[model samples]
Target: MTQTANRFHRWFAEPGPRPPLGTWLMSAAPSTAEAMGHCGFDFLVVDMEHVPIGVPETASILRAIAGTPAEPLIRLAWNDQVLVKRVMDAGGKTLMFPFIQTAEEARAAVSYTRYPPQGVRGVAAVHRGSQFGRAPDYLKTANDQVCVILQLETPEAVERLDEIAATPGVDALFLGPGDLSASMGRIGEIAHPEVQGLIAHAARAAARAGKPIGIVGPNPEMVGGFLGMGYTFAAVASDMAMMTGRAVEWLAALQGRVQAAEPAAAY
Candidate 1:
């Protein structure tokens, strides 16, 4: 493992004063990757599950983040072994697995991240994770340095959260509000009273278990709300959304000024 990967590993074991803030960067564009790193976020979650980022493109994006301090995280589409190993092989140190609902899933995630007694992650230090195939201590250190985060997105997951948290090698628990709300029969209403209550309950459980929790909200208001509720890590927004929102607002303002100027000129 590289020093950067070791840093994230230490973060989990020692814990930190403040939970780092990151933004989700789903667009596979190299420019998007560079912009996300330059935006000053502590980390960036590269979306592989929903986006069309194949292995090669993902590697390029990771390279794009090389000069910046912001860490690159990949959210694998599913809990498949091939996908997990591929991401790790391609220089991914932190991974967010989706809809992990049971201890078995947690164990599987751990197994895929490690080698031997720790896991069955293929033994090959010849990837970007090993500094383009050359971290001498890669095998001995990879397991210890990887950060494994699981998404709790269903009612069943909420009920079994304690067990999941207790599962060894599970670094963090993240809440997928949209899916959680939908599972609770309140689709698209994450802020509904009952939904909020459920979130609070889960947060309390995670806090008591001493595992960091993560969330994604569009703006500071929602980010503040999650942090105030005891969530350790939070993603304030997405790269795509941030860019689109700024562009739309700027265009609207410019068009409004143009319309006003047109009326005055007609006088």
Candidate 2:
């Protein structure tokens, strides 16, 4: 279908309250994507990075999300160009590039979504992004329209955070807490004071550089705090986390003094 306005893109550029809130979709199920889309989230991430979702499935999720107000964003498994091209061709409007540790990597990720002369994305006028060739003006607009957000999860990345945020064509920066904690040797202790300090530092650096930065948390409290600390956007929780959490919560209410189910292994 032809997209007339870039709502998500404008959300960032517009002066507003906290930049939108979002959540991770690792379910790979179109039903889940559609359900979450209708839940009023400002955006929904179709996660291919940790989820076992392939290109075709991603397209399905995109279609499902397209039916609602939530803007669909895809997190690529790596900083690979082919994956970038395929995701864009499938009509993913925004891409979240993971584990980007340097400025060069940040630039490369943006380049993958653009055409040559501006960037290196291969042109495909007949792809879904062009509504299968129905939208003749797609080629002229796609380059300026696709949004890019890079994930910085390591201390090395935070150390050079300013440079990475300054990279040309990079729209926003996202902190991956799970990986950042690991990089800090805290290994899942995201709340440990040391990790918190580094995270706060990165947030301030990004703010000074005048870029909207965001983070994903396993819970609302943590993500809420990040927004308080000056993050522009955040994904407060994941589909899996909310599903299992509510199941356990309701079960405990029924069975007095019952224990919550064993936690799933962290991905």
Query: CA lDDT of each candidate?
Result: 0.85, 0.87
lDDT of 1 by residue, 43-62 (tens): 88888888988878888998
Best by TM-score: 1
lDDT of 2 by residue, 1-267 (tens): 556566667877884855699999977899998999999998898889889989999999999998998888889999999999999999887899999998999889989999888999998768788898998578888888888999999999988889998899999899988899998788989999999888888889998999888898888888888888888888977898899999999887977533333233232
Cα error, candidate 1, residue 35 (Å): 2.0
Which residues of candidate 1, in runs, are more than 4 Å off? 14-17
Off by over 4 Å in 2: 257-267
Q: Which candidate ranks first by lDDT, i.e. highest?
A: 2
Query: Where does candidate 2 have its weakest 10-residue lDDT segment?
Result: 258-267
For candidate 2, give the lDDT.
0.87
lDDT for model 1 comes to: 0.85
